[model samples]
Target: MIDVILADGFSMLTTTLILEALRFVNLAHRRKAFDWTIKGVQSQSPRASNGFTFSAQRSFEANAEPAELVFLNASYFPDAAASPELLAWLRNA
Candidate 1:
């Protein structure tokens, strides 16, 4: 499984491109070769710097099982106050 960890203000194009490539590969193979889950550091939906808001399937938690692969996508500076929690999760991950 592939996990997409989206940061606030993440690039829509970048996410789309990556997901599209995986989608194409699945089509070519005629099977679900790649499966992804979009997750947020917080429970709230993230809003991009360009004003694009998107929802995540789940929020990162310390006890949650890790995915086979993780994609970290961040396009803008994250709020300083929230960094520690994210950092801790990353460190543990």
Candidate 2:
């Protein structure tokens, strides 16, 4: 799994849980700035820094790390949506 460790162990945990839940349905995700979208949920573009892992580790002894998951984008997804209902609409279309 790709990891984008920004900050806040709690937030990271939440992101991890959501990430895993989406994976079960074979979710396709991508990043562009902070523009994030999911098939069946509110679209929230998480802001993560590219230098979190190495830099944060050395700087603040962070618990999370940042890795490239750029390929996980809307274009690769099977019908994009801000929400699952929207995904359903996309499928129908």
Candidate 3:
């Protein structure tokens, strides 16, 4: 499984491209080749720099399970989205 951490003000284009690429891989394989979860600092959806919201599957937690791969999506003012909890989680991950 892959975990995509959606920081506030994340880059919509980059995020979409990554997701679509993964989706295409699965489509080409004709099966669910990869599974991923979108995570955010909060349970609510994370807003993108373009004023769009993307639904997050879950919030970051200290005890959350680590994925085989992880991607952190951030854009403008990315440092603003780095909470201590998130930093800790990333460190452990």
Which candidate comes out best when scored by lDDT? 3
Give the clash count for model 3.
Answer: 0
Model 2: per-residue lDDT, tens digit, 1-93?
333222221233445455566564454444323332222112233222221221222211122232333122222222332345433433343
Better of 2 and 3 by TM-score: 3
lDDT, candidate 2, equals 0.31
Per-residue accuracy of model 3 over 1-93 as CA lDDT, tens digit each: 999888888999989998999999999999999999888865458889899998898876768877989898877867887878778888877
lDDT by residue (tens digit), candidate 1, 1-93: 987877777788888888899999999999999999988765548666677888888876656776888777776665622577666766665
Q: Which lDDT values do the candidates have, in the order given?
A: 0.76, 0.31, 0.85
Which residue pairs clash in candidate 2? 29-72, 29-73, 30-72, 30-73, 39-83, 39-84, 40-84
Q: Top TM-score: which candidate number? A: 3
Which residue pairs clash in candidate 3?
Answer: none
Indicate whether candidate 1 or candidate 2 has the larger lDDT: 1
Model 2 misses residue 23 by how many Å? 0.6
TM-score, predicted candidate 3 vs. hidden true structure: 0.91
Q: What local lDDT does model 1 show for residue 44?
A: 49
TM-score of each: 0.81, 0.22, 0.91
lDDT of 3 at 88: 82
Model 3 lDDT-worst window of ten = 37-46
